[model samples]
Target: MNWLNLEHLLLDESPDRLLCQDPDLTLGQLRRQALCAAAGLQARGIRHLAIHLEDAGELAIALLAAWRAGVSVLLPADLQAETRERWNPQVDLWLSEQPGDTRLGQLYDAEPLPAARLDLDQCSLSLCTSGSSGEPKRIDKRLRQLDNEVRGLEQLWGAELGNACMIGSVAAQHIYGLLFRVLWPLCAGRQWVRRQLPFPEDLQRASLDYPAFAWVASPALLKRMGDNLDWPALSKVRRVFSSGGALPADAALSLQQRLGQWPCEIFGSSETGGIAWRQGETLWQAFAGVQLTQDAEGALQVCSPYLAPGHAEQTADAARFEADGRFELLGRLDRIVKLEEKRISLPSLEQALVNHAWISEARLGVVRENRAYLGALVVLSESGLHALRNLGRRALTETLRKHLSNHCEALALPRRWRLLRQLPLSDQGKLPQALVETLLAAPRGKAPEVLEHKVQDDGLQIELQVPPDLACFTGHFPRTPVLPGVTQVDWALELGQRLLELPPRFAGMEVLKFQQLVRPGDRLTLTLRFDAARSKLHFAYHNQHQAPCSSGRIVLQDSATETAHA
Candidate 1:
C-alpha cells in the first residue's frame, strides 16, 4: 500500500485497515473514537491539553482527536507526579490514565464519525527536550512538520520496511521515538505494538511473533544487551534504528556482529527533526532535502525541511565535512570552558577519552576547589575493569592520563577521574549538567567521593572515598586531617532517607562509636537499615579492610513538629 499522507490518514484509508496490536481493531473504529473525542474537545473549547497514556493505542486516538479538534497537545517525558506539576501552568487540562480521570469511553460521543481531511498546517504538537544539555524544555512543532519528517523517512526506508511491524524500547514522548515508533507506522499504513518493550528479553520474544519487524533502540540499551540473550530470535528483524545519542564505535560493532547489520544511526534532536543518518560508517549522509553547512567555528547549520519554512537551525554540534557532501560529527561545541586561563573543549577531551580502550563512556565536568579544574566520570570496559582490579587506582589513573595525554595538550587533561558501572542518564536517556556537577564534587556540605551506591528492598549500601581536597579537611587538623564524625553521621542520614524513604526529620542518635581514623583517599562502606515500624535507622561504617570504622543508630520523625517535641 502506498503511504497515506497524514493529512488524509483518516479520510483516505479503507475502513478495514488494521490499526495496531489488537487483531480486531480497525481504522474505522479508531476513526470513530477520534471523532468522538474531537467533538468533546470542541464542546469544552480546549486550547491545549497535556496528556499521558500508558497504552499507545489510546494515545494515538487522543492525538488524532485533539488535532481534529484544533487543540494543541503537550507530551511530557514521563507520567511522574512531579512532571505534571512542573508543566501544569502550560496546559488547560490533563488527559491521563492516572487516578481520578474520567472514562476515556465517555469522550467517544460522535457515533457517525464525521469524515474530513486534516488541515495539518493548523495542527500543532509540543514535546519535551531529551534533557541531555539540562532540564528538558518544551519544543513545539506543527503537525505538518512531523508529517513532512515521516514522509521523508518513508521515502528513505519504506521499501525495506515492507509492511513490517513497529516495536521498540524507546519511549514515544521524545521526538525520536515519536517519529519512528508511532507516527511513521501510522502514516505509512503499517502496524505497531501498542506498548514499548521494557527489556531486550521482551524484544526477543516480540520479534519472534512478528513475521517482519523493526527495533527502535537506544545506545545504552544496545550496550547492555551484550551476548546474554537468544540473538537468533531477532533474525527476522527488517531494520534497527538508534538515536538520542551517538552509538559508540565498539558497541556498534558488537551489535553489527550479533544482528548481522549495523543499526541505522539517526543524528538529530527535538529542535531539528531528522537531519542525517549513518550505518556502519563514521560519515553521515544528509537527508534528501536537508542542506548542511558550517559556521565560522565549525558548528553545523541545518536547513531541514522538517522545520517550519525559514527556520534554519544553527546547532551546537561541531562537524567536519568531506568533498563528497558527507560529514563527520565532532562532539558538542557548546561545552568549551576556561580552566586556568586555558580554553579546553570538554567534548573534544571526552571524545579522546572514550576512544581509549580503558573507557566505554566518558563525561567531563567542572570541579571547584580554590580554583576550577576538569574531572571525569567514566564507565570502564571489561579490560579496564580487569586492570583496575589488578593494578589498583593509582595505576589505572596513571594509564588513563597517559592515554589522554596522547590526544590532548597537558593543560586539557582531567585532574580527577572516577570509574562507574554506567553513565548518569535520566529516564529520558539524557545527561543533566547539574547531575554531572553533583557527581564531580566532594564539597563541604556534600557526601564524600561516592565509590558505589547499591539499593536493595530494605536498605542501601554506599562506598565512599575520602578525597584529600575535601573542604572540611582544610582546618580539621591540616597536618593530620581525618574525616569529621559529624559529616559521617550526616551522610548516613542523608543516604538512608534518599534510598529507604526514611522519616524526613532528625530526632536523635544512639550507640555512636568511632573506631578508626579515616584519612585522605581512604575507602569506607556505609550500610543503612531502616525499621519503618519504629522510625529508626541503623547505620554502620566499615574501613576498606572490612573492619568497623563507625557505628550508630539514629532516630527520625515524620515532621519538624514531631522533631521539636523530641
Candidate 2:
C-alpha cells in the first residue's frame, strides 16, 4: 500500500534482461538513461513536467526521470493544441520527442545520478478524461493509487504470464494503456514493445517475433480482426486485454475461435481505474480487494483501493449483482432521454435500429435546434446498401424508422438520419461526441472526388465528380437527385482555401449565384484565384460542356485579425 521503491527496483533487475526491442535496451541501460535524464531535469530546475511522447520507450524513460527528479508528471491523452493550452499554466516544462522541443535524448550523455528514494505519496500524475461531450476533464492521480492497481493486476494474472513481453495497440497516456502496457510491465519486470503496435498487421508481426506476449488493446481493434489474419501467429499470444469500451459478444466469440483464448475485458473509467473484468459470456468478476454495490437507481458504485480514498464512487452504468458476487451490466443510465414529454432510451432505440436486418450499426442522439429532435447516424449492412440503391435514401430511411415504430412510440423515432459506410471513430477507437454531433449537423453528401488537378501560378484548377449517393443529394428531390446549392458554396470555399492557402476565418461572400442546376454525377471544373491583397478568393464552377454552373467571391480574414474582431 506504499509507493514503489523505483530507485533500487530497476537497478536490482538482471542487467541483461530484455526491456525493449528494435535497438534493444536492457533494464540496467534504461535505469542509467533515466537517471541521466533526471539529473538534467534537476540541473534545469523543472518541477512540473508535461510528457507528450509517442514512443513508449522514450515515454517510459521520461516518466522515470521525472519520478527520480521529484517532479510531478502531467500525462495528457492527446496532444491537441487546446489540451496543451489548458495545461500550460500548471506545467513548468514539456518533455516531448517533437523537433525543437525539450527532449530526453538531449540528456543521454549527462552524468547519471545516484538512485534516490521516491516518496510515492508526493508523486503526482494528471490525466485527462474525455467526458460525454468530448471535453477534457482533468483527474489528479497519486503514484500509490496507481501502484495499488498494478499490484492487484499482478496478483490476479502475473503467474500465468511468466516472462511474456507486453505489446499494446493503445497509447500509454490513457489509464488502461498506462497501467497494462507501461507501469504494470515495468513493476512486474516484464518486457514491453518499445513502440505501439497500432495495426493488426503490426501485432501479427510482433507475435511472430516474440514467442509469448501479452496483448493490451481496445475493443475497436478487437472488433476489426477478421478471418483473413494469420491465426498461428495470434495463437502465440498468451493473453489479450481489452478496455476503452464494451466488446460485442460476436467479437468476443470470434477472437476466441481464432486465437484459442477469450480476451479479458476490463470495465472501468479514467477515474475509477480497473473495476471488473470478464473473459467470456459470463458475469463480470470484480478484481481483488475491489467492492461493488448498487445505488437506489440500480447504478453501479465502486469502492476499492484502486480508487481515490473516500466513499464508493458512483458510476453511470446500471447493473445487477448476481448471487455469485459478480455483476451483469445493463446499459448506461445517462443515455435515457425525454422526448416530447416521453421517456425514451437512446441505447434501446439504437438496439432496435441495429436489430433490423438492414442496419449494421446505429447511434442515437438528440439534436438541438429550435426544439430538440432525435437523430440517428447509421452504418448500413450489405443488404441495407442494396435497399438504398434500389429504393433510394428517403425510402431506406423511412423503412428503418418505420421498423423502430413497432417497438417504440412515434415520438421516440429519429427524425433525421445520416447513413455512413462506416461510423467515424477517433484515433483512440471511440466515437467522439463532438464528431458525432458534427456529422449529424452537417449536410449529408459524398465528398467531391478529384478527377483532375492542375496547379496554377496564383491558384489551382481541378475537375471533380459529384457522386449520386452523396448525403447532400438525399431529400433534395424524392425521385431525381440534384446537388444542393448550399453544398456547392461549401465545396467552393473548402477547396478554394485548402488548395490556395486562404485565410482561416470567413469574412463574407460576394457575387454568389446559382445560375444552373448541378445534378448528381455531373463533372464540374472548379477554378480558384486568390487575391491576397484584398483577402478574397474568386471561384467559378462550370460543367463539362463549359456551361457556367456557379461563381462567387469569398472574403476571409486572417485568424489573428478575426479573433481581434470578435
What lDDT score goes with residue 88 in model 2? 91
**Backbone clash count, each prediction separately:** 0, 5
TM-score of each: 0.78, 0.77
Give the worst 10-residue stretch by lDDT in candidate 2.
1-10
Clashing pairs in 1: none
Tens-digit lDDT track of model 2 for 1-566: 11233435435456666677888877778788889998888888889998988777778888888888888899877767887799899988877876666877886666878866666677788888865544678888888888888888988888878788899988888888888888888777788887777778787778777778888987777777777688866787889999887676667898899988899999888878899999986699999888888888889889999767785788878887878999888777787888778888777778788888888778888788898888999877768766765567788888888899997988888888877655655435677655676778887665897767899887889999775458676577765556787788788888876777778878889999887788755679999888999988888899989999999888889979877878
lDDT (CA) per prediction? 0.80, 0.80
Give the per-residue lDDT digits (tens) of candidate 1, residues 84-160.
78888888878877777544666776543476888888989998875668666888899889998998999899999
Model 1 sits at a Cα RMSD from the real structure of 6.9
